[model samples]
Structure formats: structure tokens, C-alpha cells
Target chain A: MSILDSIRTALRAIAANRLRSGLTALGLVIGVASVIVLIAVGQGAQQGVQERIRGLGSDLIFVKPAAQTDRSTGARGAQGGGITLTAADADAITEAKIPGVVGIAPQLSFNAQAIAQSQNLGVTIIGTTPSYADVRDARVAQGAFIGADDIDRRSLTIVLGSAVAASLFPDGDAIGQQVRIALGPQGFNFRVLGVMEPRGGTGEQDNYAFIPVSSLSARFQFLRNPRGDISVNQINIRTAPGAKQEPIETAITDVLAQRHQVVTPDFTVQSQNDLVGAAAEVSRTLSILLGSIAGISLIVGGIGTMNIMLVSVTERTREIGIRRAVGARGTDVMRQFVTEAIVLSLVGGLIGTGIGVGVAMGIDGRDISGTAMQTAIQTWSIVLAFGVALLVGLISGSYPAFRAARLDPILALRSE
Target chain B: MIHLENVEKVYRTEAGEVRALDGVSLDVQAGEFIAIMGSSGSGKSTMMNIIGLLDDPTAGTYTLDGADVSKLDDDTRSKLRGRLFGFVFQSYNLVPRMTAVEQVELPLLYQRGTNRRAMALEALDRVGLADRASHQPNQLSGGQQQRVAIARSLVVHPNVILADEPTGALDTRTSEEVMGIFGNLAREQRITVVVVTHESNIADFTNRTVRMRDGLIISDERRLQVIPSSASSPDASIPVSEVGS
Candidate 1:
């Protein structure tokens, strides 16, 4: 039979039994829809993580002090005490002769409480050089960030996080206002200079304040040795644009290794590329896992299709016999039944795709706190799901179609 | 022309094998109107089903138009059935929801590349049912449904029409009208008509009658004269006296 005739016959048969066909197609619809929605969510999460990583400059490298080797256990940082980096290390890096080296900053962090108009808020305070903002890719929304003059003069000026500024000064100006910083036994007053833009807030780095390194060292003398020995907590390095990050990272690692004498590769050296790559790997695995789970539904839907097709074959035995007696070949009967099954599954798949996309979009539009869950519907996933549905239809419908084709016309006609 | 040479059909059941048609042989010439008469359980229906290609013989050879039909495959048999023969059943077997024209057009659908509507109308006109072309089977009388079945059988222009008790459900008056249509088809179209019936009076309408008993042909005879119509009967003048009794 021609394709048009097969379609007409399939449509007529389906129309003759509308309720059964609809129920059978429902399984496939749900399966395909879930696959699309779940994968979309997974894709959205993956893209969000990638974007966050990219927002932190891809060539930015973070170097932390290596754990100290114990004299007894020979294990590095066995009890959480490690070798400390110093300001001299930062100077060595600034003075290092290396191409693609743009800017470097030494950092020290402390937890402190600040009092403004009898309202006290506990916040993390970061002490760094004036170049910290440039290396970290941080932008100031109001007023100006810390300048070299503040560091030189040892000025008591601070930059506020967006959240901290909003909390301390609800309706008034935060810049040029005095805020009292209370430590163990001493309290110093500092003026707010600027407010940082809102980066991602779920991390410890986003809810901190920035202050001049010289002022922090001078005020908190207990945190350093009396001989002016400063212990640097971390070093942030930014590479030149369009420069290969691996070579620059290796060059920095060599410099740090020579200065710290850490020949065992113990120090932790990480870049934005490494973090993004790890996140992408995790996202890919998650996508596959979700896809497989949804694929189970498709299999169940396929089984439903097969079961219904077998029932249809039995129900239409007389009709099959009549058509065969009228000159329909076994191949033609097989094609007709299989066509009906595929049509049902394909229609279900399309409906499911539409529903899945709509649901994903709805979720993306909602207000979720903290970690933003983003969903992007990929074209490849839709095509893959549709193709799988067609395959399921073909595989599920084959057995029943073949059975219908092989029926003995004489015996079938004799069937009441 | 059709010939059956010692055709044997045995059906296996839970009790035992039942020989439906045991070594039955017969010959039928073209344009001959014949009736196979038998009582119940005489294998007459089995013979009709085999002749209609609805079943196959277990053994022996059957030929139609000198071609061996017993050896043909299911597809070839279906093609032969469409081209060489048409069937009518005792129940009229007009699709219940179909109109008379659609009922008659059914058989022609099996014949490849035929102008179905024209042939259906021509056949309906031949059976004198053209006026009721749009009437459903239930709307028509028993005789009219039988006439529609006859028209369905004739629409394909088959060389032979096999009808199993075509007038079995009709009254005596309606049966005669249905028999008149068959007689006209056989006479005007020169098509062979074979019928199976238990009613001896119905057999009188055919040109030849073959009687069967215990799955075998017992007697075969040809009627030399056609029966006259009831309008011309001598009882037509005296019908008023019999109506009171």
C-alpha cells in the first residue's frame, strides 16, 4: 500500500478507538516531556556555573601557602598548622621577570564587628594592597575604591560589600561616614570609601569588606611579629589578556616554589580554568544520569505502546482477515499497524517537548534565593529525545505488527 | 466452467477428525443455474465454503476455468476469488450501516482498477433495487436485502455467483421475488448461479437440482420447464374462498 493509504487507514483505526489510542500515547508523552525538562534544568545549571567561573577572570590564579611538614609525622599540616607566606613573597613576584604577568596582590583576612549608629554587624574584613581590585576583577559602585595614596599614608578607610552597606546604612549615604571597628581590646574609627558591586553571594568572598593592608597591619599589631614581619595569607595573580594561562601559571608556580622551597608540589595553585573544567565535568555527568533516568520512562512508555498494539491486533482480527481476504499482503498489514504505533509515539513526543520547555521556562522565571538555577533548552536534546521516541515506537510496534501480518486468513476469518 | 475432482476436507476437533467433505467430485458448465439440496449436517455448507475459496481442501484437486485452484496460495486464491467468483450468504450479510449502493459497491472494491460506482448502480438496476440505493439494510424488506446481496455479488462481473440459501429467511411471496431476480441474472447476464438450499420449493426455481445425503451426492436432475408466476395461477381466480379458512 502507498503511504497515503497507510496513513488513512491508521487514522481511521485510531478514530474508531479514540480513547484507547489517547491513553496509550499518554505514557510516551510524559516520558519525553520529563526527559526534556530534566535535561534542560541540568543544562541550565551547567551554564550558570560556567558563567560564574568566566566572570572571575579565566587567567586569574590563586596561590595559597603550602602545609608545613611535621617534625614527627612528616605529614604536611597534620593539625591544621601550615607554612605562612609573607609580604616579601609578593614583592618577589612583583619584581619577577616574566612575560604575561599583569598584576599581583597579597591578602590577609580577619573576622571583626563594626558599629555604626549603635547597630553592630559582624563581617569578614580582607586586608590587601590597592591592586587587589584589579587582580580580582572587582568594580566599585559608589565613590572610589582604595588608592595607592591610602596605602602609603596608612589611612583608615574601608570599602563595604553591597549587603553590608545596605544593612549599616539603610536610608543614608555610606561613603565618607564614620564606622567604628571593634577588636579584642581596641576600637578604631574608619570612613567608608566605596561599595562593591554584587558578585555571587553564596561564597565567603562576596560578603567581605576591603581595607588597606598597611592600616590593617599597623592597627592589628598582635597579628604580626614585633620586628615588622608580615604573614601573607594568600596571593592573587592576574595574567595579560590573550596570554596562555598554563605557561604563566607554571612560571608563577616555579617562582613560588623557589621562594618557599616547596619542592614536593604541596602548595595549592588553582586557576579559573581548573575550577570551570571541574564544574563542567560534574555537570556532564549529572546530565547523563538525569537523561538515563528519564530514558527509563521512555522504555516504560514503549512497553505500553507494545501492549496496546498487541491488544489492537487481537481486537481487529476480523478486520485484518477481511483486508487480507481482499488482497492485502502480510507486509501491507504489518506496515499499517506499525505506522499507527509510530504516529502515536511521535505525537506524544512532540507534545511532551512543548510541555517540558514550558515548564523549564516557568521555573527559570521564578524567584529563587542564593544559587540561581538557570535552564536552557538545548536543540540537540530535543532532537535526541524525538529520535529516541521514534526508535521506541519502531521497536515496540514490530512484534505486534509481525504477528498481525502472519495471521492465517482462513483461521482468522473463522474467528467470530 | 468449474470442476471438482474427488476433493476431500477433514477437520480436526477435540472429539476426533470430522470428514466435512469426503471425496466429493462434480462438474458445472457455464451459464447453468444449479441447486445443491440437502438436509442438516449433509456437508452442503462445507462444499459451498470450499467453492467460495473461504476454505481449502485437505486433499484432491479442484479446478476453475481449467486452472488448478487447490494449489494456489492465499494471495493467488484471493485474486482468483475477486476475478472469478462472488458469494452470497443466507443472512444477506449486507454491512448493517451501509446503504444499498454502498453494499453493492463492496465486492467491486476487491477487483483492481474497476469503476465501482457505475458497476454497482448497474448491478442494483439489474436486481431491480436501483430505486432503494440509499436505504439501509434494516430499512429494506428481507427480499430487498437479499436482492442487495445479489447485486453485490453481480457487481464484480464474476463468471460464477455462489449463493448459500439466498431466500432462506424470506416469506414465500418474497422468496419468489428474490428467485425471480436470480432467474433474470442467470438469463440476461449468462452467469452461472449455484445455490445450496434445504427447501425443495426453492430448488424448483433453478434449472438443475443435485440432492445430497451423508456427505455424498445422491441424485442430480434438470427441470425442463420454468414455473409460472402466481398472477397466472389458476388459484389466483379462487383465492377469495381460501382466505376465509
Candidate 2:
């Protein structure tokens, strides 16, 4: 028979047992859907994480104090007793004159209570210079932010985080307004100079207030030891365009080491670029793990297809015999059955892809807490899932198809 | 033409070897209508199967249309079967779901590279079942079903038609109608027809008869020619021995 005739015959045979064929196809659909959905979700999560990392300037680097050892035990550093990064270290970075050095902001953060009207909201207070706005891409929604004068003269000025401003001044403007902020054992009032634009919280820096570094050090007193010198908790550095980051980071490390008089590399200087790289690696691993789990369902679907095909062969033994007697070659019979299997799987793969894409879109549209993860259905995932499904169909269908083809005509004709 | 030389067919059962056709030799010429008569287990069916190329002989040099069919492989045997023989069975063996036209079309389909529908229609017309072509096997009478089977066999224009108890499951009147169709095909079309029947009455429909006993031909005889005018006249003399028997 011609290819068209064989296809028609195979379709007719499958149509004869509609319920069985549908059930077998359903198995493949579920299998392919599982793989598609899992991989899509994994890809979405990875994309979301990378987006968050990108949102925080890819070239930005963070430096934190490393562990300090106790002289008696000589084991490891005290968990909270590390030396602070002072403004002198920030100035030392300027002296090195490294190219691609955009901005450096010395930061000190502490939990404090801000009282406006009769309401009191506890929030973290971040103290940094004017350069923080450009480096962090922070924009003021209402009024102007703290400038170099505020950091130089220790002006009592602050900028409210979008969420914090909303809570403290429910119905009024926060700009040019004074809010009393009680820090630790002492309380002080600072004028709110600006209200930040709404940025949905990302990472660990949500619900905080920003103030001038000099104002924070002078008023809080705990921000400085008895040395009457400015102290910083951490330093944030933004790199310039087209400049290699590793060399600049090394220069920063050397500058901080000489200023702090620490012999060993006692601080952690991490590049945001490296963090992004690490996050991508983690996402990739997660996607593979999820894809494997989805692959299991595909395998189960394949087995189901094989099992159903085997049963079909047994059920249609007499039919096969009749066709054989009518001069159908063994290879022809094999081709017919295998084609049916592939059709089933391909249909399943298509349906699963639709369902998976719908699910990814649904999840992406919903509003949730923390970093908002984005989902994007990759074309390769679709191709891979469908290809795997087709392959599974062929692998699963071969044995039963071969068995049907090899049946003796006489014995099959006699089969009940 | 069909020729069998020292044909032997052995069946290997758990009990032991049983010879179905023990050194049987026979020759059938083209256009001859022959009936094979034997009791059950006398190997008449085995001989029919071997003749139809449905089973191979254990040891034989069987020639059909000048080719040694007994030595051919399965595929070659199948091809030759399609080209050389058409079959009718006691059960009709019409694919139950198929319409009469489809049943007739089957043989032509195996012949390949032919317009199956035209051949099938012509075959159905030859069997006088052109109008009943669309009716499935279940809708047709026993005689009509047998006619469809005959059409199926004749559609491919094979060298011979092989009938294995063609009327074994039909009523006496239906059997007569089926046998009449076979007689017309052999007489008018001059196509060879071989039938297997144990009934002596069934053997009378053929031009020649061969009776088997103990896997061997006990008697082979040609019937007396019928005068057409006497066959149609009421004053035709009936043989006294046949009437008394």
C-alpha cells in the first residue's frame, strides 16, 4: 500500500478503539505537560532572580568586614565584633585613582523608631552620602534628597523610604517635614528632605529610611567610638563603563587594608557581577533538577503508551492476521503502529505546551511578596519537551509494534 | 495447470510425526472442474491447503503454472498465491464488517498496480451480485455470501479457484445455487475450479471427481457429458441406478 493508504488504515484502526487511544494519548499529554510546566517554572524563577540582580546595578560591589579572631583561642572571628569601615577608607579609594570608578558610598545602618503625628513605625535607618542616589539608581518622588552639604556639616536631614513615608505621613507630604526618630537608647528628630519613589522591595533593603552619613554619626554617637571619627558599617562601590572590575576590586582591597592596618585580608570584597554569576549558576542547577523531575513523568507516559500498544496488539491479533493474509508486509504493520504512537505523543506535547505557557503567564501576572520572579517560556524548552515526547513514543512503541509485525499469520488468524 | 510429485506433509505434534499427505502425487489441467472427496483426517484439507500455498509440503516438487511453488519462500508463495489462486471457504470467510464490494475488492488489492474497484465491480457482476454489492456479510443470505466469496476469488483473474467445502455450511437449496455459480464459471469462463467435498451429491456438480482414502487417491473419474436439450426437456431419461440409490 502507499503511505497515504497505510496512514488511513492506521487511523481507522485507532478510531475503532476511541476510548483506549484517548486514554493512551492522555498519558503522554500529562507527561509532556509535567515536563513543560516544570521547566517553564524553573526558567521563570531563574529569570526573576537574574532580573533582581540586574536591578541592583550589575557593576556595583559590596565590602563587608571579615571575621576577626580572638587572640586567646586563635580560632575564628567574633560574630559581631569586626572592625568598622571608616570614611578614611572611602577617601583612600579616591587617592588610588582607579579608572571606571563611578561612585563610592560609605553606609551605616541601624534600627530606629520614627514618630509622625501619633503613629510610630520601626524602620531601619541607612546613612549614606549624596553619591548613593546615582550609584543605587534611587530617585526621589517628592522633594530633593540630602547633598554634600548635609554630609559635611552634619545636618539633621533624612529621606523616607516609599513604604515608611506612607505609614508615617498617611495623608500629608513628607518633604520639608520633621519626624522624630528615636535611635537605640537616645532619641533625635530629623527633617524629612525627600520621599523616595515606590520601588517594590528587592533583597534585604526594604522599609528603610536614608539619612546623611555625617548627621547619623554625629547624632547617634554609637555610630562612632570615642575617637570622634566617622565610622561606616559597609561600603558600596559602583564601577564605570567598559572598565574591568576585578582590578578595581583588588585596588579597593589594598587601599582598605593599608588604611585599617590589618595584615591579613580581613574583609570581604564581593562584586555584584560575581553575585549575578553565582545566582545564574544556581538557577541553572535548579532548572536541571526540575527538568529531571518532569522527565520522570515523560518516561512514565512512554511506558503507558507502550503498555497500551501492547494491549492493542493483543486485542487486534486477528485483525493483524487478516491484513497479513491480505498481503501486508511485516514492515508495513510496524510502521503503522509506530506512526500511531508518535501521533499520540505529538498531540500530547502540543497540549502540554499550551497548558504550561498558560500556567507561566498566570503565575507571572499575580502579585506576591519578596522579589517578584518573572516567568518566560523559552522556545528551546518547548522544542526539547516535544522532541523528548516524540522520542519516548518511538522507544515505547517499538517493542509492541515489532511483536505485532512478527506474529505468525496462521496463529494470529486463529487467535480469539 | 497444477502438478504435485511425491508431495509429503508431516505435522510434528507432541505425540509424534503424523503424515497429512503421504507421497501424494496428482495433476490437474487448466479449465478442469475437479472435486476432492475424502473423510475427515484422510488429508483432503491438507492437500487443499498445500494446493493453495497456505501450507508448505514437507517433501515435494509441486509445480503451478511451470514454477516450483513448493521450494519458494513465504513471500514468493504469497505473491504466487495472489496471482494463481482465489479461495472460497466453508465459512465464506467474508470479513464480517466489509461490504460485499469490499470483500470482492480484497483480492485485487493484493494483486497491486490495478484499478481494484473496476475489477471488483466486474467480478460482482459475474456472480450476479452487482446490486447487492453494498450489503455487508451479515445482511446477505448464505447463498449471497458464498457468491461474494466467489467474486472475491475471481476478481484477481487467477489461474484457479480453490473452494474448501464451499457449501458445507449452507442449506441444500443454497448449496445448489452456489454450485450452479461454480459450474457456470468453469463451463462459460473456462476457468479451472477445484473443490473439496466429502458429500457424493456435492461431487456431482463438478466435471470430474477424485476420491481419497488413507491419504491416497482411491478413484478419479470424469462425469458423463450432459446434452443441453435433454437437460432442459421434461422427457429426459433419469439413470435408474442413480434414482434407486
Candidate 3:
């Protein structure tokens, strides 16, 4: 006498109940696929942050006013620490000619409405030297950037960011056009100098306008300090390629501290590498959150699998008895039932993988929520998801399989 | 050959203990065709189950081919049952949606053998069901379904065939047809055959009849055979003690 292998018997049994089996596997398919898709999105957000940071320019140090924690008057102390760095401080750092300092650019910034033709949009107005373009990697894609003569003459010339250019001048001929930079009803007109090259990602860099600091002081007289110095927002220092940011940052800080004549400097210095590290830490946390939520769905899918298996056992009670009558042992019956369950989950896992991969590929470069969506598919995620599916099959299927094996042959044989 | 020594079977229920079989002892040599006759609740089916090794006697020793099988483990007993006995039931007990050959392949499916399909076909041929090998139980007549079940029993080449109410579901003609197959199996294959039934006419087909009542064997009678075979000198009457405690 010869019997088909346990797996074959299980396949036949599953085939016999095609609708039920298919429905049972549907839960697993959705669970696994959602896991892959959601993780891809989360990882994509992380990748987006890392890419934006890398695009922020390398070997650079940022000097900004420190947020002071004053127990006496906390909120007003924050206002006091604001705008401590000025254009004169930037001039001091540059004139010092500290070794390895490639370029120096200080910025005075404000959010205002920029209007051209019939179009007007809220944009960040950045007042800085022509060196701001070089130190910040803001390449000119059109005619030219703000010239040194523009800073000396305090000319009302503007270099539009990629997004601002596209918005203010749909004709793409903004090199000689006039755009109105306004603070409410009071406004000033500036000539368009050039459009900066397009930077990917929906970041502030691509939505800003650059102008001369002298022009900023000329237009807004109230912004000048008592010493007639132009107060700047932040200073960006670019170092030579492959140069360390620490020594360059210390030199710039010392120069500024001497210029300000303060014992404890009222500024904080941060490197680009520091920001990148913080972004990575954030991504790790996001991945864990995404992974656990998906895992719960998979467990729910496993419970669905167990439910059907138990029902199948009860439905086939007489079949079990018939097998026993024909000399099948308890283990043999258990093996057959367990094989069916594993087949269900593994098959579901395989299909889920295919669908997940296909979906991740399909939406990689899609634009969702005004930003390009990027997906990074990790191979380990696929392997781990499939492994968990196999485990779920074994755990959930165990009780039902043992129950089938332990059925009383006499009673089972008598069941209709 | 099969032996049961003073077997007693008790079933525990919520109400009380019910003794299905009380001090019943019986023996049959190889290749004997015997019938167990009794009314409902007379324990004929219980005796068949014990003899077929599908169940154990509550308080007795059941020896099969000189082995004390009462103490055998479940797996070991299952293997012995597959190797030693072929079972047929009144309902045919064929797995649904399976063809005749597939049903015949059931018993052999538990054993390790080759040419399973050919062997199944051969068993079908024994029951004159070779032409119906691919027909499912639902597609066949009641008599044909029973024949297919008989073929399933024969596929494993078992030494003994124990049938419980094998023809209870059949018409008179089909009953005769099914019993004829059992008789031929006993005579031609030299297999020991036992059938449990309540009908006296059904018992007439067997060479010996064991009449049971109230969980006791009332009489054991041997019929005079037209074609004499076996040890003709047999016990005329086997006494069974009263069932009461």
C-alpha cells in the first residue's frame, strides 16, 4: 500500500476547499503587503531627509544666536539673544583670513510677499553678499547672481530662487524683470538679477530670494543697531574640501567674540555633520514605529489563519476517522493538517512579497503631498517578513493540527 | 486467527456505567466465515470493534496471531490493524469525492508498497468493479458502493475481514451480492470473515452463526457445509455467563 506524501494530501485538501483557503490567505497577503509598503514610505522619508542634508553643502559651519535659558525672564531672554551677529562681525571673520576658511556669507532674513506680473506669493527674503551663493552652493542657472558692486551701491537687485523664479516669471525671462518685495502695503521694487539652479526637495532654499545686505539696511532703517551696524540673522562659513569644521569654527567664533567684546559668546556653532547625525537618529525611530505597527497586522493575519484551520478540522472530523480506520496514525493526521497550514501561509507570503515589491517599485518616484516620494527596499525586511510568516504558521497551526490528531476515532467515525 | 479471553467492556456515562460486553470470550481459526447476530444494544458492533482492533476490551486480553495486542501503543496498534484486518461498514464508509480506485487505495495507502494503482485495480477486479474504478461513490449504486468498499478492504491483503452490518443499507438483491463477495473472499482468498448483523437471513450465508442477547453470547451454531472445508469438528455451543453483577 502506498500513500501520497503529506504535502500532496494537504494540497489536495486545500484545493478541495478553494474558496475558504483563498479567503484565509487573503488576510496574510494584505498584512505582509501593507508592512512592506508602509516601511518603504517611512524609509523614503528618512532617505529624503538624508539627501536634503547632503545637498546642504559639505565642510560648512553655521553660527547663529544661542537660545539663552534665563531663569529671571525666560521668554524675553530669547528675544535678547536674537540677532546678535551683524554684517560687521561677518566682515571681521572674512578680514581675519583664518587659514582653510574658503568663503564667508552672513544672512539677514525675513518672510515677505514677492509680486511680479499678476502673481504674488509669500517668500523668504535673504539679504547677503555675493559670497552667499558660493558658500551655500547656490549656483546660478541663469544670467548672474548679486555682484559685489551691487553690495557697494546698495542696488535693489534680486536673485530669485528656483521655485520663486518659476512662480514670479512663468516666461522664465526674469534676468531684467522687476519684482516687488513688500512688507504689507509698503513695498520696494528690485530688479531681477538671475535665477539660482533648481535644488530638489521642498526645502526653504528653493523658495527664497537673495539680495544685498546694504539694500536691506537701506530699505529697513529700523533694523540698524545703535552703532549703525546691520544686524544679520546667521553666518555660514565654508571650509576647503575635506577640511575639518572644528578648528575653522573655533577661529570664526574667536574673531566674532573679540568683535563683540564679550566673555561668553552669545552664539552657537554647528557643523553639517551634526545635523546629518540627528536626522539618522530620527529615521531609526521612525523605522521601529513603522515595523511594529505592521507586525501587529501580521499577527492578526496569523490569528485568521488559525481560525480557518480550526474550522477545517471540525468540518473534516469524519475524514480524520476514515483515515484512522484505514490505518493512519495520529501523527500522520497531524502532519497532513500542519502541512496544509504551512502551505497557506508560505504561499500567502510569496504572493505578498511579489505584490509588495511591485507596489514599491511602482510608486518610487511619485509625487505625494507636494514632495517627491522615494522608497528604499531593504532585502532584510523581505526575508524577515517571510520568516515571521513561517513562524506564524507553525504557532497558529499547532493547536488545530494537534486537535485533529487527537480526535476520538470511534466518535469521529460515527459523526455524520 | 483471532482470540478474546473473557472480555468485558464498560461505558461510563453521566447516568451510570453501561456494560456493553460482559465476560464474552470467542475464538476463530484462520479462513472462517462467521456471523454475529443480535438486536440493537446487544453489543454486536462493540464486539466487532474489539475484534478489528479499532477498540480495546475494558477488562480482558485480546491476542491476535499470538501477540497480546491489548497492551500495544496506539501507533503500533494502528500498524497492526492496517496489516491484519480489512473493515467494511453498513454506510460503505468511502471518502466522498473519491473514485472507486481511490477508495480501494485507502487501506493500502497506510502500508508501504509499490504499484499502488495496479493493486487498487486488482482489488476492484476482485469485487467485479474494475469497470467502475474511476466512478465516485455518489455516482454509483448502493450495491456498487459497498462493492467498492469491499475492494478497499481487500487492497491491503489483510488476513482477516471484519464487517459490521455490511449490508444493512442494501436491498435484498444487493445484500445477496455483497454477502456473496464476502463468502468468495473467505473461500478463494483464505481470509477469515466476520459479519455483524441483526437479520437471520444474513447469518444464513455464513458457515457459522453466533447469536447474542443482552451482552452475552446465547448460542454458537455451525452449519453443515455443502463444500466441506476447515476442521469440521467444532464446538456446538459456547456458554456466556449472565451479564448482571
- Which candidate wins on lDDT? 3
Higher-ranked by lDDT: 1 or 3 = 3
Residues B97-138 of candidate 3 have per-residue lDDT tens digits of: 778998888777777877889999999998898999999889
lDDT of 1 by residue, B1-245 (tens): 68888888899999999888888888988877788999987888778777877678999888888888887776677677766676776777665456899777765554556567888898899888899999988899888888888887787788888888887788777776776666666766778889899987677777788888777778888766543433112122211112111
Best by DockQ: 3
Tell me what TM-score chain B of candidate 2 gets against the true chain B. 0.91
lDDT of 2 by residue, A1-416 (tens): 66665566667666767898888878878777777677877888887787778776657888877777878989886533575677767777877887778888877777889998787999988888898888787888888888889888899888998889888988868787788899768888889899887767363444779989888778876777567767777788889876788998898888888877887877778888888889999999999999898898889888999999899888878767655655556676688788878777777788878887777677774666763646667788888888999999898889999998888765676577
From the highest TM-score down, the ranking of the candidates is 3, 2, 1
Docking class of 1: acceptable
User: Model 3 chain A, poorest ten-residue lDDT window?
Assistant: A72-81
lDDT per prediction? Answer: 0.79, 0.79, 0.84
Return the DockQ of model 1.
0.26
Per-model clash counts, in order, read 0, 2, 1
User: Weakest 10 consecutive residues, lDDT, candidate 3 chain B?
Assistant: B236-245
Candidate 1 C-alpha lDDT tens digits along A1-416: 56765776677677668899888888888888888888998888888778878866657877777667877987656321453666777788788966887999888777899888867888888888889889988889898899999988889999988878877888758999988888789778999999888776344455678888878878886667455856667778888887778887888778878977867654667777888999999999998888899899989999999999999999788667655544466787899999999888888888988887888788884557764567888888788888888899888889999999899765665466
Q: Return whichever of 2 and 3 wins on DockQ.
A: 3
